[model samples]
Target: MAGIFVYAETKEGEFRKATGEILSRCRGVADATGEPLVAVVVGPAPEDAPRRLAPFGADLVLHVEGPGLEVYTSQGYAWAVTSCLAGRQPAALFFGNTPLARDLAPRVAERMDAALHADCTGLAWEDGRFVFTRPLYGGKLLARAVSRPGHPVLATFRPNSLGVAEVAATSPAYERVQVEVPAGSVASVVKETIRQVAGRVSLQEAEIIVSGGRGVGGPEGFRVIEELADVLGAAVGASRAAVDAGWISYDHQVGQTGKAVSPNLYIACGISGAIQHLAGMSSARCIVAINKDPDAYIFKVADYGIVGDLFQVVPALTAELREMLVRA
Candidate 1:
């Protein structure tokens, strides 16, 4: 039987949701394959991470502690994981397609001469091998790939793709693991990792996202959109045009050049749905578009559409939602 390995990530001394998603997905693979779910955590072990993973489903947790790992370095992190994995020789290496995963996964695959599949939207075992499906051609096509013959098949999953539900279970075992950090790897010393200084939630992790575009007129127009977002308990996002115009920060930009987001509800206000913008948010469960132009590209894929002025429509919608909540 082949063993399953998961690379769980941590942020600000806590396990990120994407980490739990990968771990839970690996647990399913392990049960089906009759193997153990071996999860590896790089950097310091947050006190709550091990216990949090157990209920979600993990057989064994491997905590790899290293000083060099305090901040994310692509080569250093990859080296540490590759070293610890020598003993177990896992059949597959799973990662949540985060920024670090995007940088390090391919490097690890190249080092091991293993097959690599990135941004997988779904996964399943077939014919004694894993089949991963990822979007291609600007989310217009779905590509299914199989791993080549190798000791460890590397796969990175997209955020919000896997729906991992936690259930009550007996706590699993935890093991302390140590690895030697390679000194002569890539020679870029990252002095400090500056988290974007803002009060906004990250686009990839938000449950609801309210996005604006050029059709909103100017930076001042986004104020109304922000009110709607606040009423809905959502984060504000913007098209490339809005960011280019300095109407919003780059972190709030939703497009191919920015961040890919798959929220539960994505409301587009005045966005024309450029291919680049759709590429980032097409995975959203529900889409609502509001624009005066009926021919706007955003309407093509929107589940709900309203042809009207966003300034007027947004305030009315916000008021209604607030009233509904208060009455309830």
Candidate 2:
């Protein structure tokens, strides 16, 4: 059977949240096409990758590892993925829209002569074809795309789009493929990896986000936003204005040029809601805007709006939440 394959990505030996999300959704895609759900793990994958994937609708787990593939080198990973696809010839291959996938997926598509779609936010099976929906013009418009018949399809989906949900667990078999990467295949090697420490959840995986903007006044002003975020156990976010103002780091930025987020609850404090910023978080399940400006654009998309001094309102909101959450 031509199966539906997923590139199961990992961080620190555990599955990334977006990986689980793609698998959970693709489980339906596999069932619709009457094909096995296959997961491909590559490059420093966990030894228990197969065991971990079996309960997530995976019927088969393919582990690919070898010299030059132990760490992520685009050339090395691409070679493994393209080779696995050649042998399996799956109907479609899905990947989370991680930096690694953005680099590797295109290479695989090119190698396999497959149709490629990137940054898809939605997926569905209809009329005997798989449909992928992606944003265009910096998230102002949307477009649906499909692949030509008789061609393998490769797609990358944005994180936090299709959230993880339970799927019928299946006992899955495992296999390993060791390909000695040829010389010159890997152009560069990573000598050391330096990781940043973040006390809160990763923005892409966070269910709730508390964001601040220029109205925050300064970097120290973010303390209130952080307090609110702490009360809700949410991640902290910032608009491009705050980032450009040097009030926060770019890693916390949310905008057209920054990270797109789709948290369950997005709280925007002191943000004027520039279109670019809205483009990043408009898909949040619920938006709460707190701005002193009554006509701020953030109110347009907010599920709840509070027109007042964010400096005063945010602290009060934080205190109230802290008390309520503690009691509950």
Q: What is the lDDT for 58 in model 1?
A: 80
Q: Tell me how far candidate 2 lies from the true structure as C-alpha RMSD in angstroms.
A: 1.6
- Give each model's whole-structure lDDT: 0.82, 0.86
Candidate 1 residue-wise lDDT, 1-328, digit = tens: 3468888787777776777777776666677778888778888767766677886688878888776877778888888888777767688888887777899899888876778898888888777778898888778888998865445799988777776746444376788777668668757799877888367666776789999998788889989888988888888999999999988888888878887877889999999999999988888889999999999999999999999999889899999999998898
Task: List where candidate 1 sits over 4 angstroms from the true fold.
Answer: 148-151, 166-170
Candidate 2, residue 167: the lDDT equals 95
Q: Residue 238 error for model 1, in Å?
A: 1.3
Worst 10 residues of 2 by lDDT: 193-202
State the weakest 10-residue window (summed lDDT) of model 1.
163-172
Error of 1 at 137 (Å): 0.6
Task: Please list the residue runs of candidate 2 whose C-alpha ends up more than 4 Å from where it truly belongs after superposition.
Answer: none
What's model 2's TM-score?
A: 0.95
